[model samples]
Target: MGAGVDYIFIGDDFTGASDTLATLARAGRRVRLFLDPPDAAAIAEEGLDAVGLATEFRALPAEAIAVQMDVLAPLLKALSPRIVHYKVCSTFDSSPETGSIGAAVAVLERHLDPALVAVMGGQPSLERYCAFGNLFASGPDGQIHRIDRHPVMRNHPITPMAEADLRIHLARQGLQDLLLLAWPEIEERRATLKTHVDELMRAGKKRMLFDACDQGHLETIGAALGGCGSDGRPLLIVGASSVAEALSGDLRPPGVAAPAQGSRTEGLCLVLAGSRSQVTAAQVKAARRFKPMPIQPRHLADKTAAGAFAASCAAALAAGENVLAHLAPTEDYRCSGAELSCKLANLVAAILDRQTVCALGVAGGDTSSIIVRRLGFRSLAFEEQLDAGVAICVAASDMPQRDGMRLMLKGGQVGSDAVFDRFVSAMNTKSPTTPSGLWRHHP
Candidate 1:
């Protein structure tokens, strides 16, 4: 088949890919989305042509990976887009399947020109809770480096590389106005980040971006360094679960409850707690305790309910109605099997229908990882931050039938205070009606 489009979004889940497409569409780019079979209608409703791929679900990681590759091969061959955008998980290294990256890369190599494939690796863990730096860079050699110091990075385990080494790497890549993303897990590392940012500025780096997933940090950083991106561009920071904390000014210490009657908006809050059953339970309990209103909980295990909810939410959002979506797996805690796969396909399909979801949230590590993968991303990974905190994603819908959604990956054990705060804040700052639909949700 002849090449039919200019861009291909691979690896992201229904919600994320749709949101990204919404963002791109807002920028006036004509894009075609390829998602799993179940999400085709959501894509079609959004006025974008979407193709679905068939594959096996819930097999061993290796086997499942094979199925993914086999299904995507034909679509890649047929579309032949100039740009193949892979929305990869940042925490792939932590997954059971060791060769996911290699396998995914191999599949892409066969279908698209390697040079044209740009991997947008989103850090799901760092996006949920407060982290020290905005963004960090890791080279192919496995060395880690950062662009600025973030308080949360202090005393963390993730290693930090020398600023000089990072600079050398970037210079070698001939990357100008480049953004670096990293999870700085120690005090020394945070210091190193500050130094790096200063050095990069001194070196005349035009644009520097970081991932600040928490709200308080965003404001603090915003105050400390006014004007986001260099040269008048908003510095891009991926704010995750802590987005609510930043927005609602509720970055209180864990266990400290905010007043019972606080002003908060109604929207979906996705609490992404990896497979820890206890963590998921706590989030449900916490939501009941702190929410401004009685937030109804919907168990998504029922495929029909899950799918219908997803579709209704998408359609509502497309019609310019504010929506709050909180997607958590069932109490059974089953993922990565044939049954789970089918359920996920339905959920994703629902989300894809309405690209611009007003406020979206996801919890659970495995759930986060799987969702990220479904979005057509290739290199990003999700790490555990704060034991378990909710990651928050926020996006706006400007035009009818298009969607822009943001993501915040929160740890399960993290307090509900931070999660709720960030969600409210994101809703408050949503962009009003604009010409193009933009999917500016940070995952």
Candidate 2:
């Protein structure tokens, strides 16, 4: 490897991290996403071009984020890779008090002391775009709307976007004075991009945002990032998985084909949909092979009721029926998403203790983070791309029936309506590469 690790990314959530892992691995880059901090052996893994750390950062407050970064800064500094990417959501729907992107950058900058800090906007693959320093995202209606007016994100229960101008939105979160390198500059084939960025750095411009809406735009952004940075100090980048997409073209040589597809996993599969997003609700409605198990937030509050709920889910799977556990569409969950996630995780643990499933699927950003963390998985590797934002990952763990399990982790807004049905069918195949392990009866 050129360096111990060529690129490093810290995802704001588990779903985003898995997506980025898929993006990089599909590009033929050797990479791993660790749920916890990697030890020396992990960093020293042979032939790996990139290393990523997936966190529940998107669910944490500034103080909690700072505390976690304290443990991570030293290890990250030791890698000293060419890039340290603070990967965030494409919609950039983060709040100052919760999942504060600016607070995180401020902390990381103090520790890593990067030569430059930049934000790469727009992941066209996800239908999120940036123009004139304003963010936009596609809605369920397939209409591109400014982020603030985005149908789904506007009403997002947490960290909703209300400002389309990224500068103002970020300033509220403490990331101030961002210089925009708009799309026009990127479009004109301005060969001076790298040179201009260096000049901006010299002028005390600590942070910059690069606009992108297409693959060509990403190429320009990547070219600019590729040219900047010192020998020992890597540039710090913040954005979605598009950061990895851009880097693939700029840093890695071409002709790295994706790995062969694994075979479908056989036997029963368990899916948990803890998101209230309309996308997930639609997916749940469209599922046919999976028996719908509606979970109410109130049902999880009482220990007795939660135990009974878990038993019911186990019974369905035990009866040879694939189970799709989702939040009931009826009531509003007055609890925080984190609270709901923990409760849902408990159900997964309980079900696994009673029934062995070939694969596990979880929908929801916060729910995936909490459940995967609780599942005791050491690392997640790119297994397959089931859909646009949906990645089927392999879980490496030392726990019962978890090792070599395939995980379909998706954000609420990711995947098509038939994603759950597809997940079940994908795992029901007889292929060998498909993991034969997942949640099994512990006894």
- Give the Cα-based TM-score of candidate 2 against the true structure: 0.93
How accurate locally is residue 385 in candidate 2, as Cα lDDT from 0 to 100? 73
Task: Give the residue spans of candidate 2 off by over 4 A.
Answer: 1-3, 250-257, 260-265, 430-443
Tens digit per residue, CA lDDT, model 2, 1-443: 22467788999999999988877777666778899888777656544668889999899998898889888988888777888999999889899888999888988889988888898888988898999899998888878999998998988888888898888988898888899989998887567788788888988998998888788898878888886666677799999999988877632222222435445447788999988788889999999998888987566878888888888999999999999989975677677778889988888988888887878999998999999988889998776677887877888899868887888999998888888988777677554453211111111
User: Of the candidates shown, which would achieve the greatest TM-score relative to the real structure?
Assistant: 2
Per-residue alpha-carbon lDDT of candidate 1 for residues 1-443, written as tens digits (9 for 90 to 100): 53343334554233233333333332334333332422334333444332222122212364466567667767655644333444332322212242243355445555443421112222332342213322453322234434223222221122122222222322332323344433342222443444555455567654443444434334443332322233322222222222212212223332222122223234443322332334344455445322221112343556566666666655655664444344344445344333443455346546665453334444433345455445443221111112223323222234342233444544322334344444545445433322122122111
Model 1 TM-score?
Answer: 0.39
Task: After the best TM-score superposition of candidate 1, give how far the Cα of residue 28 lies from its true spot, in angstroms.
Answer: 5.2
Tell me the alpha-carbon RMSD of every candidate.
13.8, 5.0
Model 1 misplaced stretches (Cα beyond 4 Å): 1-3, 12-34, 37-60, 94-99, 113-360, 368-417, 421-443
